[model samples]
Target: MKYPVLFSPIKIGTMEVRNRYVVPPMATGLARADGSPTEGHVAYWAARAKGGYGLLIVEAAAIDPLGKGSPWDEPGIWDDKFIPAWKKVTEEVHKYGAKIAIQLHHAGRQTTHDKIGGQPVAPSPIPCPVEREMPRELTTEEVYDLIEKFGDAARRARDAGFDAVEVHGAHGYLIAQFMSPYSNKRVDEFGGDFMGRMKFPVEIVKNIRRKVGNGYPIIFRLSGDERVPGGRDINDSRLVARVMEEAGVDAIHVSAGVYASTQYIIAPAAVPPGFNVYASEQIKKVVNIPVIAVGRINDPLLAEDILESGKADSVALGRESLADPELPNKVAAGLTEEISPCIGCMQACAGYLFDSTKSNISCLVNPFTGREGELKVEKAEKSKNVMVVGGGPGGLEAAWVAAKRGHKVTLYEKENVLGGQYRIGAIPPTKQDILKAIRYYITMGKKYGVEYKMGVEVTDDLIMKENPDVVILATGGVPLVPNIKGIDNPKFAKAVDILEGKKEAGTNVLIVGGGMVGVETADFLGEHYHNVTIVEMLPEIAKDEQAAVKFFLMERLNKYGVKAITNATVREFLDDGVVYEKGGKEEKLTGFDTIVLAMGAKAYNPLEEKIKGKVSEVYVIGDAIEPRKTLEAIEEAARVAVKI
Candidate 1:
């Protein structure tokens, strides 16, 4: 009764989903390179299903050999050999009272030759604006053949025990490429006019319906608006929805943005929640099929509102589900506050996907996302008194985990507040969602019966007095004030101080260093119409940030008229200006009312060495161990706490 609409069952074709919640397809890169599901994939999906999600749409699986999105481990339905692996996932999901669906995908021009073993194919020979690789225009015969390939994929999905199959026609993939004039410039019947452009996807739906039968559920996911200048918009999507509906599509899952508008695709915290709802609403009016709204629809209340307002029949949780797989169960039980909020940092999720270093999707706040099978909170062999220093994310998580495992935990924070640097990190524009995450941890600590002692700085004497069996130092970090000339001047302030409101910047400002903190600071200051200039010693600004985040940050900076100078090393600070070296030349850039140093932080582990012998077990986590991202800090804390 808490969320009747959200918990209400809905019929998609002949199948009935238990609720309006749908886990839309998101690429995890958790499969084998040969396009087979790994044990990780099986465990990941099963956990979400067991968590009470009504329906789970598995991540995109290529329909053919050349359609694979990345050179890495993206699942595929091209081969029957892959069916058994996906069948394992569907069977596991079904065991938990959930209906499972698979998204049949084709990368088209979005992929590279190195990825698919040949040049990527598209509706036209034109290359993608971002990828900039010319694709071999699919011959008319090849286009029909590709349609049959989609049918074959749908058939395989049914054979694999999936209740429904969603066609991946969004986010600048093959179907989207053909629909958008921006990507599809071909004069053939598959392109050109609106109906011509939509011909490919319509035929695809018909082909899928033919293979899966008229009664089989078919979910068609498409970008309601490509968000590009000349790209397909909601009006076009409305027509496409009608066509697909007439072509036997069961439900329409509406999302927004193409790859070029990448920020709108994954959607960082900077983008507001329910961004694609308007688009879904527009499409819903034109079509009778159940319309599912996606894109930053994180909060359960918002999902309920969207459904209650008659915007869409279903709400698709993408990255939000990754942050907390048990979101549905939590909401259904009226334990909404306990639901871990997706902060939308995108650090481990989209960040890893774009970075190519750590491509396996994971959550920033939830450490047990991908490793549900491996990383579990088992009860400790013996109860222990745990002393956690600092009430930042790391300490809070450690305390919560330890206390949940039946340990007596005391969490100490030198300051009155719980969040450490995270509070300052959330001070940036559109980043207030982070405070929700901090509040969740604080609530978890209290719920787990952690003894929270505010304004209590843990020292050697305090550790000895408390006499705890284990001590975790999440003392966090301090600003690294580099030993530069004139750096001690009072006019220069730390980035954290400005963000924390302890210090203020003037109208004209110069920030030294262009890391995540510095860039976010510039954005925060830029919002106030401050004239900001960023100087970075690296080749690129915000180099340490995720690609999509950095892209949006740079766009914001440009919009705010913030200037950036990269590969410029600051030598000294002047009373009126800053001196730096760039390309072996000494340059003096003068004209700043105040100077800010966002040169990153140094680990603050003062108590670790002091309390080593005082405690039975000593562990260091978070910035106290080494300055790292929030994801690493929380994960490290959980990893250490669970074992203890």
Candidate 2:
């Protein structure tokens, strides 16, 4: 009753999904180098199925060796040997009463030559704007052959016992390449007019229909709006949807953006929730088959609203489900508070996917996401009294986990409220979701019987008084103000002070440092101040930021007209402006009414040294150990707490 529409069953072709929730395909990179599912992949999907998702669409599997999106470690269905591995995944998902689907994919020009053992193939010789890897145009004969390859992948999926299959036609892949005027400039029959561009995907659907038959469900994932100029928009997607439905497709999974606009694909906190619903609504009007809306549809209540408004038939959860596998179950049981919300940080999920060194997907808040089988919280052998210092994310997570493991926990915070510096981090209008993690931690802490002592600073005396078996110091960090002339002037303020509204900026602002904090502060100040300039010693701004996030942040900076000066070192702070050296040349940038110090933070671990020998066991985490990201803080806390 809490979310009737979201919990209700829906039929796609002959298949009946128990709810309107669909886990759209997300690349996990948890497969073997040869593109077979590893035990990690099997356990990952099985966990989601057991958590009560209705329909689970597995990550994209390359249809052929040349179609791989990544160089390695992506599942593939090109060979019969891979069928048994996929069958195990399907069987595991079915055991929990969930229908599973496999996405048959071809990366097209999105891939590199090193990935596919040769030049990547596409509708034309044009390359991706982002990747910039030129692809050879698929020959007319090869185009038809690729369509048959798609059919072959679907037949293998059926033999593997999958309930459905989805064609990966979106996000500037091969099919989308043919559809977009920006990517496909071929004058051949495969590309020219709208219908000509539509020729390849249409033939693909028909071929897949022939292989899977009319009974088996077939979903086509489409980018409702490519979000790039001259690319396919919702209107074009509406036509494609109608064509696919007429071609016997069972459903349409609507997503947005291309590689050039990758931020919209796996949007961060800057993008609002339900970002793709409007496009889905437009596409739904032209098609009879079910339409699934995706992109930052994180909350169950939001999902319900989208369904009740008649925007789409189903709501697909990608990263939200990764944050909490049991999200649907919690919603159905009216235990929504227990569900861990995805903060849209993108640090662990999309950040890792984009990192070639760490391609495995995980969640920032939930450490057990990708390592489902290995990292489990088991009860401690003996319950111990635990004293936790600070009330930030790390301390709260440690306390919650320790309490769940049958430990007596008491968390102390110097401030009246919890969340530590995270409170200030959430002050930005776009970053309000950061506070949701703190709220979830507090809620779960209370449920697990963790005691809280607010306005109580945990000094050495306090720890000795408590005399707990274990002491965890998450004392957090302090703003680092460089020792420079005139730095103590009233015009200079810390970034946190400005964010928290403790200090006000003038018409012109100069922010020192160009890391994530500095760039974000520049974004915040740029909105109010007419002139905002950020100076950093590094060659680039937001060097530590994830690629997709950095891309969007830079776009916002450009939009706001904020001037960024990198490779500049501050020599001194003057009353009106700052003196800096760039490329070994001294320069004076005047006319700044206010200066903000966003130079980052230093660890506040005095208590760790104070209570080191006083406690039987001592641990330092979060900013208390060293100022880092929320992902590192929460993960370190959980890893240490579970062992205790």
Maximum-TM-score candidate? 1
lDDT of 1: 0.89
Q: Which prediction has the highest lDDT against the true structure?
A: 1
Per-prediction TM-score: 0.97, 0.96
**Poorly placed runs, candidate 1 (over 4 Å):** none
**What would the per-residue lDDT of candidate 2 be over residues 492-551, giving only the tens digit for each residue?**
889898888889888888888899888888888776655888999999998998877777
Cα error of candidate 1 at position 223, Å:
0.7
Kindly report which residue pairs in candidate 1 clash with one another: none
Put down candidate 1 lDDT per residue, 201-273, tens digits, no spaces: 8999998888888889999999999999999888888998999899889999998888788888888887788
